[model samples]
Target: MDSKLNRSVIDISICSRSISDQNSSETGKESHEKKFLDKNFTTKRHLKSRHIQLIAIGGSIGTGLFVTIATGLIKGGAAGLLIATVFWTCVMLLLTSAVGEMVVQYPAPSPFVEMAGRCIDEAVECAAGWNFFLMEALYIPFEITAVSSIIDFWRDDYSAAIPISIIIALYTAINVFNVKYFGESEFWLSIGKLILCVGLLFFTLITMCGGNPAHDAFGFRYFKIDPFGSGYVTTGGLGKFEGWLGALFQANFFVVGPEYISMIANEAHYPVRKNLSTCFKTVIWRLCLFYIGGALSVGILIAYNNPTLVAANTAGESSAAASPYVIAMENLNIKVLPDIVNAIILLSALSAGNSYFFCSSRQLYSLSKRGFAPAFFQICTSSGVPIFCILVVIAFACLSFMELGTGGSLTALTYITSICTKSQMLNYLYMGVTYIAFYHACKAQGIDKSTYAYRSWFQPYSAYIVTFFLLVLCGVQGYTVFLPGWWSVEDFIFYYIMIFVNVAIYIFWKVIKRTPFRKSSEVDLVSGLKEIEEYEYEHFKIAEEAQINSDTDSEDYKKKNAKEIFNNVKTWIF
Candidate 1:
C-alpha cells in the first residue's frame, strides 16, 4: 500500500510538471492575473467538506418544499403532484451530475458564468452572470416575504416591516463578517431544517397510521378518492393539463438551484475530486428524501379538496395558514405541532434568505472580477468578505417592505417570484448547455474524459438531454396564461419577462461584441487547469514528505494511522 501510494504521488508530480512546462513553453510567460492560486485576492478557502454538503442540502430544500408544495397539491391533486415532483427530481439529479463534472475540474466562484466565457462565449458569460445575480436578488425578497408570512402564525398585530428589518439585518451581518461565519451559520441552519424534515416525515407516517387524535388513518385515502384535481382556470382536459404544468413548475422551484452548491464549492477548503464527488453523491438522496419524499408525504397528509386548502389558495396568503402541513395538523386536532412547524418554517425561510444574500453577493463579485461589473464590486474586506457586493444585495432586501402597504407586498412578491422562477430556469438551462460545451472542448483538446478526476455518467448525452428539456420547460412554463379568456397581462409579463430579459441581454451583447460560439479546439482550459494542478501537486509533495518523516519516527508512527498523520500534516499546510 505504501509503495503504491508513493507511486501515485510521483505520477501526479510528473503530470503537474509536464503541464507547467507545456504552458510555459507556449505562453513564454505565465499569466499571474489568470491564476487563482493566491489567497489574498481570491475568496478564502474556509468552507469545509461538511460546509459544502449542508449548503447543497440547505439550498435545495427551501420554503418551496414546506409552503409552496401546497400550491401544487391544490392544482394537480396528490397523484399528479407526486409524479411531477418525482420526475423533476430525476431531472435535477441529471443536471447536478453534469455540473459536478465541470465544477470538480475547474472550481471557481460563479463557475457556470466563468465556464461560459471559457468554453462558450463571453456574451453568454455576461448574460448568465447578470441573470443569476438578478434572480438571487429577487429571491431575497421572496424569502423575506415568507418570513413575514410565517410570523403571521404567531402574531397578526405587528407590521411586516419589523420582522423583515430584523431578518435582513441579521443575515447581512453574517455575510459581512467572513466567509466561514456564513458557512458555519448555514451549516447549523441546514441541520435544523434537516431535523425538521425528518421529524415531519416520521410524524407523517404516524398520522397515516391513525396515531392522531382523530384516529382516522388516511392511508392513501386522498389518492384513492381523487387522484386528479378539478382544473385550474378551465374545467376539462385542458384545465387538468394546465394544472399538471403548474405542479411541474412548482417542483422546478423546489429543486431549481442546486447549482448553488457548486458555486459555494469554489470557497471550499478542498475544492477537488473528493469534496465535489461526495457533494454530488448526496444529491440523489436529497432529491429522494427532501423533495420527492416530502411531496408524497404532503399528499398523504392533506387531501386536495380539503376546505382549508381551498381557502388558503383563494386568499393567496403566504402565512402558515396556507401550508398544508399546518392544515393537516389542524384537522387532526394536533394543536402544538402546528405552531412548532410554523416556527421551523420561519427558520427555513431565514436560512434561505441567508443563502440568497451569499449567492447574489458572490455573483456580483465574480462579475466584477471578470470586468463585466464595476471594479469596486471586486473589493473584499481583509477577512474575505465582499462588503460592497453584500451591501448591494442587502439593499434589494428592502423590497420586502413593500408588503406593509395595501396589497403592495403580495403584488411585488407575485411578480418577483415569477421572474425569479424564470431566471432560475434560465440558470439551469445555461448550466446544461455549458456542460455540453465543456465535454466537447475536452474531447477536441485530446483530453480523455474517462481519466478525468470526476467523470459524469452519461457525459455529452446527458447534457444534451437536460439542455433540451430545460429549453422546453422555460418556454412552456407560462402556458396557462395563454388559455382562452384567461389572459391577464400582469400574469403574462411576470411569467415571461425573465425569458425576454435573458435573450435580450444575450443578443444585445452578441451584436455589440460580435462574440461568436467558441470553437472546441480553441477553448482555454490550460490556464485554469495549470493552476489547479500546481496546487494539488504541492499538497501531494507535502503529504509525501510528511509520511516519510513520520515513518522514521517508529514510535509516533505506530501510535497513529498513516491516513490520520497525513491529514494532520495537510491541515497544517493548508
Candidate 2:
C-alpha cells in the first residue's frame, strides 16, 4: 500500500511539472495537434460565400471538360461517354456527400487530410498528404500544357516556351499575392466558364433543332451509332463494352469532387459551416448540370464517327479545333463562335491550374502543420500564403516546360492526365475509407451524426458502394495497356504509378514511424472541435452584442439574413 501511494505521488508530481513545462507536455499523443490549429490565427479568411461557390464551380470545370472530352467520346463513343459520365458523376456525388459530412464539422484548412490521420491512421495521412500533393501540384502543369494545346490550335508559329513562360509568370503572380485576389479572379473566371457551359448547352439545343445555317435537324442521329459507340480495342458488343470502360477511365480524370471544394475552408470567411454546407449541397446540381448535361449535348452535337473527329484523332491532334462541339460548330459553318469557345476554354484551363496551385500549397501546409512534413512548410506569410509550400508547387509547375519540345504538349497532357486520374482515384477511394472510419468514430464516441448541421443522403452504405467501384476502377484502370496491339510501356507506367506509389508511401510510413492503426474509439474528434466551436461562438457573440446595444447592425443583420436566404435558394435551384 505504501509503495502504491509512493508511485501515485510520483506520477502526480511529474504531471504537475509537465503541466508547468508546457513544451514537455506537448510531446504526448496530441503533440502534433497542440500547435496544429495555430494556423487559424495565421491564415486569413477573405473568401466570401460567393467566392467559394464560384471557386467550387470552377474546380469542376477544368481543361478536361473543354479539351480532353472528345478523347472520351473517341474511345467510348457518344453513348459510352454519356453513360460513363453519369456513372462517375453519381459516384462522385455520393463520395463527396461523405466528405461533406465531415467538412461541416471541422471546417479546417484541407481538413479532409486531417480527417484521415485522425480517424484512420497517420500513415494513411502521410500517404494521403503526399499523394494528394502530387495530384494537385501536377494538375498545375497539366492545365498549362492544356492551354498550350488550345493556343496552338490558332498558332504554330511561336515556340510553346514563350507562352508557357507567360502563363507560369501569371500563375506565380496570382498565387503569391493575396488569396482574396485569387478568389475574386477565380469568381470571374468561373463565371466565364459557367457562361461557356450554359452557352454550349444552349448551342447544342438550338443547332440540333435546325437553328444553324445547314438547318439540319439532327435529333440524336448520333445515337443510332449503337448509342454506346464503337469499342476501343475490338469490334462488336465486347468492343462497345470496352469503349464504355474507356470512357469511365476518361471520366475518372475529369471528376474531382468534394476534396477540391473543401480546400478553401481554412481561408473562407466567418460562418464556415453555412458556407461549406452550401458548397456541398450545390455539388449535386453542379455535376448534373455541367458534366452530364455537357455529355448529353456533345452526344447530340456530333456523332463519334464524324470525319472531322475521325481525322483529328487519326492525326493525333488534341487541340480546341478537335473538340467535338467545336467540330460541330465548324460543320454548321458557324465562324466566330468557335474562336470564342476556344478563348473561354483557355481561360478555363488557366483558372483550373490556378485553383490547383492554391489548394496544393495549402495541402502541403496542412501536412507540415500536422507534423507529417517539415516544420518550415508550416510557416505562413502576413497574407496567409504558405510561401515555402507555394515555392515547391511552383517548382513542380515548371514541368509544363517539358511540352515545349519538338512535339507539342498534347502528348504530355495525355500522360499527365492519366497520372492525375490515378491520383484522384486513390484520393476518392481513401475519402470513402476515411468516412467509414469517421462514421464508426462518431458512433464510438457517442457523438450524434443524426444531429449534424449537414447530413448527406444514404449513410455508410454510399461510402461502401463508392469505395468498391473505386477499387475496381483503380485495379483495372491500366487494363487497356494489356489489350493486344494497344501496349505501350509509357502508358502503363503513367497509368498505374500513383497506385504503386501510394501503397509504397503507406507501407514505408507504417513500418518506419510504427504509426498504429488508430481504432475508431481512439480518434481525436475533440482536438479541433473546441476551436471551431469557439470560432462559431465568437461570431454569435458579436451579433448578440450588436443586438444588446440596439445598434443598427441588427437591422443590417436581418437584411443580410434575407439576402443569404435568397442566395441559398437561387444557388440550390440553379
Candidate 3:
C-alpha cells in the first residue's frame, strides 16, 4: 500500500469522538473530551420511527411525481411507465445499498461526503460535500418557485419575491426551534399529503365504478377522448412510447428522496444496523405504496392528455392539471372539494421543503467535523441545532427564487431541482466506491465479522451491480444533453457549475493550506454516533433482565411458597 493510504488505515482504528485539536476560542464551542463530544456540538436524538417513516413517505410524494409525471407520461406513454419505474428502481437500489453500507459501517453524520473522503480522492470528498450543500441550498429557490406557480390557481399575476421571503422566514423559524419540532412539523406535513393522495385514490375508484355525474359514467372512455383532442392519448399504442419515457424519467427523479432514512443514523433509538435493515426491507413497499399507488390512480382517473395536465393551461411546464385529482373531480362534476385538495398539495410541498432543510443542515454539520469544512459550522445551539448552518441553507433557498420572472416556471424549477437531484446521484456513485474500499480494508485487516453492525445482503456483487447502474444513469444524462432542442442545455448548467466550483475550491484550499487527503487510518467513524449503541445496550440490559425475571414470578409468589420459590431463586442465580 502507498504510505498515505497506510496512514489513513491506521487512523481509522484510533479515531475517537474528538475534533482536530484547535484553540477553543476559534470554534466558540465548549471544551471537548476524548470520549463524548462537546455538549455545544452534540445533536438531539429526538426523531422516532414515525418521524422516519413519514419522512420517507413525504420524500416519495413530491411535486415531481404528483404533477410532473404527466409530462413523462406524455413523452413515453405506457412504455414510459415501465422505463421510469425500472430506472428509479435501479437508482433506489444503488442509493439504499451504498448508503446502507456506509451508515451500517460508520453510522455518522454526512456519510456521503465522508465516504467520498475515504473511497475516492479527497478532492472528490470536498466536491461531494459542497455538491450536496449546493443541491439542498438550491432547493429552497426551486420550492419557492413552485409556491408562486401554485398561487396562479387564484391570481393571474404573481410576484416571486414576496413568497420567497415568506418561505425563508418560515424555514428558518421552523428549523431553529429544535430537531423534534422539525420532526413533528414533517409528521403533520406528511399527513396532509397522504390524505390528499388517499382522497384522490377514492375519487378515481368512484369514477372507475361508473358513477360520473356529468359524462355518463365514462369509466375508461374519456381516457380515449384526449379531453384536449390533440390526439394520441391511449396507453396501448406504440407511437406513445416516447411520451411515457419522458414522464417515467421525470417520475424517477421525483421519487429520489426516500433514502432520507440514512439521515436518522444519529437520532434513531435502535441500532442503525437494525433500523436500516428494517428500512431497506421497507424500501420496495414504500415505492409501491406511494409512487405506484399515486401514479396509477392519477393515470386511470384522468386522461394523460387532459388539457389541465398540459403546460399551456397551467402557464408553466406540464403538470398533472394543478392537482390532477382536482381536475378529475371537476370532470366528474364534484364541487366544494377541489380547493381543499389544492391546499393539501401546498402543504405537501412545504413538508418536503422542511425535510430538505433538516437534512441539509445536518450535512453541513457533518462536513465541518471532518476538517472538510470550517469550524463555524460545528457550533450547535443549546437545543443541539446547527443555527449558523441552518441560516446559510435558508439563504441559498431564497436565492433560488431567481426563476420566478422566467416564463417556464415548472421547467425552471425542474432545471434547478434536477441539478440537485443529479448531484445526489453523484454522491451515491462515490458512496458505492467507498463501500467497496471499506469492505476490502476490513478484510485485509482481518477485522472480525462481529464488528460490523449490519452487512449488506450481497457483498462485492451488489456493490458492483449498483455501481454499474449509477454509471449508466450518469451516461444517460450526458447523452440527453446532446440531443438538439429535445434537451435543455441550461437545465444541466448547474451540474457542471457544481462540479467545477467544488474542484476549484478543493484545489485552492489543499495547495495553500497544505491539507492533503488522509489515508483510511486517519478517518473517524465512531465520533458521529458517539457510542449511542453502547450506551443503550449497557444501560438498558439490566432493566431487560429484571423485567424477564419479574414477568415469570413476583415477591408475593416467593413469600407464599418458600420451597418452590427457593428452588426457583437457586435456578435463576445459577
Candidate 4:
C-alpha cells in the first residue's frame, strides 16, 4: 500500500510539473487575468442579494417537508422522527456553516465540487462534480413525479402526463430566460410556500386545542397512542432502532440540498458576504419553523396508525393525503382546508421541480467549466443563460414520462427518491470531508480562521462530528433491507446504487488520471483569492462613492428618500 501510494504521489508530482511548465510560457499578469476569466466564463452575475436570500429559503424547504415526512411518521413514529429531525438539523447547520465559510471566501458555480478539487484531489473533484450533476438531474424527475402525485390527490381521472409535460415546459422556459427570472420566480414561489407552512402550523395548533367542529382536542393524543411507531419491521427494540433510522433518513431527504444556495452565490451580484450571511440566517429559521416544527405538529395531529398514512407509506407515495396537515384537517371534517393544503403541496412540488432544473443545469455548466464535461455545455446565450447545459438538463425531463410505463409514477418516484437520497448523502459526506481538509489546509498554509469572512464555530471539531455521522448514516440508511423477510433485490439496488456509482466514479478517475490527494500545505488557496479581493475592494469603493454622491447632491434628497421607501418595501417583501 505504501509503495502504491508513493507511486501515485510521484505520478501526480510529475503531472503537476508538466502543467506548471506549460503555463510558464505565459506572462504572469496575462496568466492571472486569463485564469480569472476562464473560471467565470459564460456565467453572468445577475442574481441580487434578494434573489440569494430567498433562494436559501426556497431551496431548503421542499416537497419532502410538505409531503414525504408522512413516511417518516409511519416508520419512525412521532418522537423518533422529531429527534431525528433535530439531530439532522444540527448536522445540516454545521454543514451549512462549513460550506458557507468556503463559499463566501471563494464562491464558485459548483462551490463544494470545486472546493473538493482544491482541498482533496482533482480526481475527487471530477467524481464529485459528475456525482452532483447526476443527482440534481435525477432530482428533476423526482420533483416532477411529486407534482404528479400531489395532483393525484385531487383527481385520478386525468393522466399525469399532461400536468407533467406542462410543468416541464413552464419551468424550462423560466430557466432558459436568465438567472434573474429563475431567482425571482423561486422567490415568490418560496414566499407562497412559507405562508402556507405558517398557516398550517397555526391551524395545527388550533386543531390541537379543539378549534375544529368535532371539538376533539388532539393535543398529544397521537403521541400518547404510539410514540415510537408501529415497530419498524418487527415488534421489539430492534424495530425501534429501525424506526429511528427511518426518521433519520426522512430528515436527511428533507434538508439534503441547502448547498444549492452556495452554488447560486457564484452568479450573485457583488456584496456576496451580506447575501451569504442572510441566506445562512434564514436557513436556520426555515429549518426550525418548517422542518422541526412541522414534524412535531404532524406527530401531534395524526397517529402513526392512521389508515391514510399506512396506505401512503406502503405505496411510498408523497401525496397530499399523506400530509399530516391534510390528515389532521380530515379528522376534523374540515373539507375545504384539505384542498387548500393540496394546492400548497402542488405549489411546493412545482417550486422544487423548478429549482431542480435550475440547479442541475448549473451543475452541468460547472462541470463543463472544470473540464469534467464537454466544453459545449459551457456555451451561454447573450442573456447569460447556459443554453446548452439547460437544454441537456431539460432533455432529462423526458424521464418523467417514464411514469406512464410499467408500475407507474409511484414506482418511478420510489426508485428516483431512493437514488436521490443516496446520491445526496454521498454529497454531504464529501462536504464534511472537504471541510476537514479545508480546516487543516488553513492551518498548514498559515491562514488564520479569524480572518475568514464567515468563520464557523467549532472549527475542525464540527467537521469531524458531521463527517462521522454522515458516514454512519449513509452506511446504515438501507438497513431495512436486511430485516428478516424484508429482503428485496430491487430495494437493495435502489438504496445502494448511488454509493456504488460514487465509488466507481472516484476510483475510475483516480486510476485513469493518477490523481493523488494533495498534502495540506500544498493545497492552493491563493489561486482565486486575488480576483475575489479585487471584486470586494471595488464593490465597497463603489458603495462609498455612491454614499458621498448622495450626501452632496441637495436636489437628490427627495430621490434618495423615495429610493429608501422602495428599499424598505423590498426588504419587507423579500
Who wins the lDDT comparison? Answer: 2
- Where is the poorest 10-residue window by lDDT in model 3? 226-235
At residue 276, candidate 4 shows an lDDT of 74
Ranking by TM-score: 4, 2, 1, 3
At residue 322, candidate 2 shows an lDDT of 77
**Candidate achieving the largest TM-score:** 4
lDDT of 3: 0.63
Name the regions of candidate 3 deviating beyond 4 angstroms.
1-39, 155-162, 214-245, 270-273, 312-314, 317-321, 400-418, 446-455, 478-481, 484-496, 499-530, 538-574
Q: Give one digit per residue, the lDDT tens place, for model 4 in 1-574.
A: 9857755665565567668967775647555444422323477778877778767777777888877888888888999889988888889888888888888888878888898999899988988888888888888888887788888886899888898899889988899887889988988888878888888889888988988998887689888776988788777888887888888888988966457787797788878776776666666666666778888988988888899778866876678877777877877789788998889878888887788788889999988888888987887775778888888888888788888877655476558756888888889989999889988899998997677667886888988999999999888888778877889988898889888888898899899889888899999898766555555656776788887777655758778788868965774565
lDDT of 4 at 334: 91
Superposed model 2: Cα runs more than 4 Å off: 1-41, 314-316, 407-417, 547-574
Task: For model 2, name the residue pairs that clash.
Answer: 231-239
- Tens-digit lDDT track for model 2 on 249-268? 88887766887678898887
Q: Which should have the higher lDDT, number 2 or number 3? A: 2
- Estimate the overall C-alpha local distance difference test score of candidate 2: 0.82
Where is the poorest 10-residue window by lDDT in model 1?
A: 32-41
